[model samples]
Target: MTERNTDLEARTEAKPLPRVSPATDILEREDGFYVYMDIPGVRREDLKIDINENEMVVTGRAGQAASEKETFLEVQFGPGEYIRAVSLSDLVDREHIKASLKDGVLTIHLPRLEKASPRRIPVQSA
Candidate 1:
């Protein structure tokens, strides 16, 4: 019998992940700004909301991992992550930003800072 020696090498390639952009609507009013986004299939546990001094970021993933192998006749949705970033100014109060997710829609409330709101000037007799 003869002895043999073998060696194996492994290689890896870097790839970029896909990102999805959800439908969003921005409304501006005298009191504040309202942001509504449509993110179907996303769950509360998979959602993330980040508020910065000058920006807001939202990211989430839709659907759950399959327990077993399955087949699909029609597939309209794919496994991906939803990401969106919005720019903000000093007029918005970052501390008061609130968000809620319901019925596959994400709502964000951005209240205007007091100094940013319009005030009526009072006149006085000299």
Candidate 2:
């Protein structure tokens, strides 16, 4: 097993907001592609996904509440907007994309266009 190195300490030491530097994985299959990202402390309503001509953008924002009294902080994570942009190939079908978030994980499914997908053609003899 491989040990994972996360920047939790650095983030929490900086500020008191949710850090948004999520990691992502991209997988390509014969039919389509899948993109998985780890976005913690983000709700469904706080996420915004957009697909432009050749780019896919994911943006999230978490607001910070004002403290009522003096408080001692043990750790802090700067809270601000999280934005990530990815460029997609033309093979993807922009109209048939799907996204879902659960358990702090966001998954996006991009199906290849019918014209771009590989098809086995039958040979005919005249």
Candidate 3:
């Protein structure tokens, strides 16, 4: 086989490949920001969320087979790594961030830093 053919074969044989298309939502509030992601067929233990500085990373793996007799008909979504990185304008308090997954919907609450929150300053006449 030619080099191109070999590369194609390798690509076809690779398992657990990422699809790269995922639905996400980011909402900003007065107090903080909320990130919502839809990840179907993913278990709680299979999901991973990481936050570093101003970047947030979400990753998960979907199982390929539920049983030996079952097979995928339309395999757009498959057993693969799902990764997404988002940058935040507001400083986030990593220590207080909360995450929860329910019914394939992952919701993450990123609280803004204490110093980053908006404060009202008293005005004085000069």
Model 3: per-residue Cα lDDT at residue 119: 87
Q: Give lDDT tens digits, candidate 2, residues 1-126.
A: 011112443343465555356688999976699999877667899999988899999988655342434243432543466677889999889999999999868899999999986779999998
lDDT at position 5, candidate 3: 44
Which residue ranges in model 3 land beyond 4 Å of their true spot? 1-13, 71-76
Sort every candidate by TM-score, greatest first. 1, 3, 2
The sequence of per-residue lDDT tens digits that candidate 1 reaches over residues 31-124 is 6999999988789999999877688999988753433234344444555679999998889998888899999999999999988788889999
Judging by TM-score against the true structure, name the best candidate: 1
Worst 10 residues of 1 by lDDT: 4-13
TM-score for all models, in order of appearance? 0.76, 0.70, 0.75
Candidate 3, residues 24-72, lDDT tens digits: the string is 9999887798999988878999998877777888988766544544433
Candidate 3 — number of clashing residue pairs? 0
lDDT (CA) per prediction: 0.76, 0.74, 0.75
Q: Give the lDDT ranking, best first.
A: 1, 3, 2
Clashing pairs for predicted structure model 2, backbone only? 12-76, 17-77, 17-79
